[model samples]
Target: MQTQKSFEATTQGILYLVPTPIGNLEDMTFRAIRLLKEADRIAAEDTRNTQKLLNHFEIQTSQISFHEHNSKERTPFLVEKLLSGETIAQVSDAGMPSISDPGVDLVKAAIEAGITVVPLPGANAALPALIASGISPQPFYFHGFLPRKKKDLNAELETLNKRQETIIFYESPHRLKALLDQIEKVMGPERKIVLARELTKRYEEFIRGTISEVSEWAQNEQIRGEFCVILEGNANPVSENETAEWQNWTIKEHVEQVMDTEEMSSKQAIKEVSQRRSQPKRDIYAAYHEI
Candidate 1:
């Protein structure tokens, strides 16, 4: 139940979310530079890293460290400063603040405190990678990073495999091979994906192909830099056999088939049967076991 008139005057100071360059420095916008220069203080994910950017542009504004570990602690302090009429700019190491970064919590707190929060768009890796990815750009899903654990990663992929929009994920250099392997295993080999790394830098590279091909290539390649994976989404999600599966099945017949085919216990089979038919497992179990 809140309305934000961004340009309206307020007693509280403003919070400007400034986006820094992902790699190349020239991508820094004039407004971004001016905001950073004029802001009373800059809240940076890594002050040491952000200092280099400030030094390069000759903008001498001081920065306070605000990262994942410290954001919760720093948020209250920053909010108080805003209430005291001190304008602040929040930035990440690269790209936009709050996009897979810790600045999100601060922005939420700022809004709740009735501070005017403004976002200045600048360079980000996903859009740059997406447009060049040759995949469908509209209706895209930005999943910042996939799960690191194997079981969770597989479960996530199961849901992602059914999405109809282009999918995006950020992966570190070391995890690229494992991520691709999971993609090939869960999403299938034919799904188109693009891997972009070192974007906007001298060695910026794009790897585009089927998941299997890219996975194979990544296996032996000398991997470096963070990667942005753009995957083509599902269009033909319903398998012909799956479409016909629900039509010919009695409750008991479905449960028996899943138990026999999947080699599962009655309880496990009941769950699968329920998911496929969109029925409650408790109800399916009652019918199958006649209880």
Candidate 2:
């Protein structure tokens, strides 16, 4: 009887941040299972999705539907349970919660409310794609997902193109080809890119080559699954012939000349010159005294 009391007291409720498998079910960690089973309540992004996983593991812990649509209303109630000493676990449909998902807001609220929040270590696609991408993982930037608008996407890619460390972007299967084409147009066709698709799954594939090559390949194949595009940093700048007629002009004039010759818009011309010169857009604009 004393031991049972001790166990109950020790089980004071806490919020557990559980990580689900991104692709393969085998990737789920044992600790995650133990915590999920032990928790008094589980908040799942999608009850149906979590039910499938729970059924496989035979975890019968009570679960509540918590997602973007209901997060605003649900978080307060979950926090109340934690405060009342009811241990709760939160899991996304896949991967870690709040990472390109809805779990982050809940975690933030829990922290602000002085509740204990625990994160379980497990599968993540970003790190794997970066490490296997054959690019410097350190000092790299992970742009969760690109903007859908063409101009917005190009602008974002332009900024990343100037970064010294590798850049990783999450892309959907349907948009992979279009994204690659934009990368080629805004950054350059010769830029190196690594496409990691269906990671850890049976059909996992890594297509590494110049942006143009990968773009062409994706165009011809039946693309499926989520994609992580890892791009190599810009190459070193090259010195152009200073005496050339186009070399000595102001940055704006040079940009205008390229726009005229290539029949590209001002934005496209700016992007091209910046990539070729291995300089940031702001610096290029400053050099031409446009800014």
Give the candidate number with the greatest TM-score: 1
lDDT of 1 by residue, 101-180 (tens): 87999999999998999999899999999999999999999999889899999999888877889999999999899998
lDDT for model 1 comes to 0.89
Q: What's the residue-level lDDT of 21 in candidate 1? A: 98
Q: Give the TM-score of candidate 1.
A: 0.83
lDDT of 2 by residue, 127-207 (tens): 999999887788888778999999999898777766777888899999988998888876766667999989989988899
Residue 210 in model 2: lDDT: 76
Q: Which stretches of candidate 2 lie over 4 Å from their true place?
A: 1-12, 235-274, 277-291
- On a 0 to 100 scale, what is the lDDT of residue 8 in model 1? 94
Q: What C-alpha lDDT values do all the predictions have?
A: 0.89, 0.82
Q: How many residue-pair clashes does candidate 1 contain?
A: 0
Query: Which pairs clash in the backbone of model 1?
Result: none
Q: Residue 82, candidate 1: how far off, in angstroms? A: 0.3
